[model samples]
Target: MKQFTYVITDEAGIHARPAGLLVKEAAKFASSTTIAKGAKKGDLKRIFGVMALGVKKGEEITVTCEGADEDAAAAALEAFFKANL
Candidate 1:
């Protein structure tokens, strides 16, 4: 498993568009991706699950990638977060 923590930079947090894009990105990897804020963790591939967390701007989130493609997945997500979230 690989993990990293990031503070959301967008004012709107992980809203609809970015969340949808995130799910699409997560689905590309063989690894399972999960993001957590506080005690709430959501599958990165599931839009509703991610949105349910209601991640707000400036809140730190921990992202974990696990499985065969964890390294790639983590790297991709890190880039995605920087570009999108």
Candidate 2:
């Protein structure tokens, strides 16, 4: 398993557009990806699950990827958060 923590910088938070993109990105990997805000976690591949967390700007979240492509998935997710979230 691989994990990274990130603070959201987008003013809109994990709203529809970016959340949709995030789900799509997570689906690209073979690993199981999860995003957690405090004790609440959601599958990164599921749009509704992610949105349910209500992640907001400046809030910290941890992303975990486990499985065959964990390394790459973690790196990509980190970059994705930096670039888009």
Candidate 3:
């Protein structure tokens, strides 16, 4: 498994558009991806799950990836967050 912690930078937070983009990115990997915030953890490939995290700007979150291609998934997700929050 691979994990990365990131602070959301988007002013609007992880709203519908960003969440959808995240889900779309997660779907490209063979590994299972999850986004966690506080006590909540949800599948990264699911839009609702991503939105349900209620991730706000400047909030820290951890993204974990497991199974084959986890490294790539983690890297991609980290890059996505860095670029899009």
Per-residue accuracy of model 1 over 1-85 as CA lDDT, tens digit each: 9999999999999999999999999999999899999999999999998999999999999999999999999999999999987
Positional deviation of residue 47's Cα in model 3 after best superposition, in angstroms = 0.4
User: Where in model 3 is the C-alpha error above 4 Å?
Assistant: none
Clashing pairs in 1: none
| Candidate 3: residue 3 lDDT (0-100) | 95
Better of 1 and 3 by TM-score: 1
Q: List the residue pairs that clash in candidate 3.
A: none
Alpha-carbon local distance difference test for all models: 0.96, 0.96, 0.93
**lDDT score of model 2?**
0.96
User: How does each model score on TM-score?
Assistant: 0.98, 0.98, 0.97
Mark the regions of model 1 whose C-alpha exceeds 4 Å error after superposition: none
* 2 versus 3: better TM-score goes to: 2
User: Model 3: how far is 69 from its true place, Å?
Assistant: 0.4
User: Worst lDDT window (10 residues) for model 1?
Assistant: 76-85
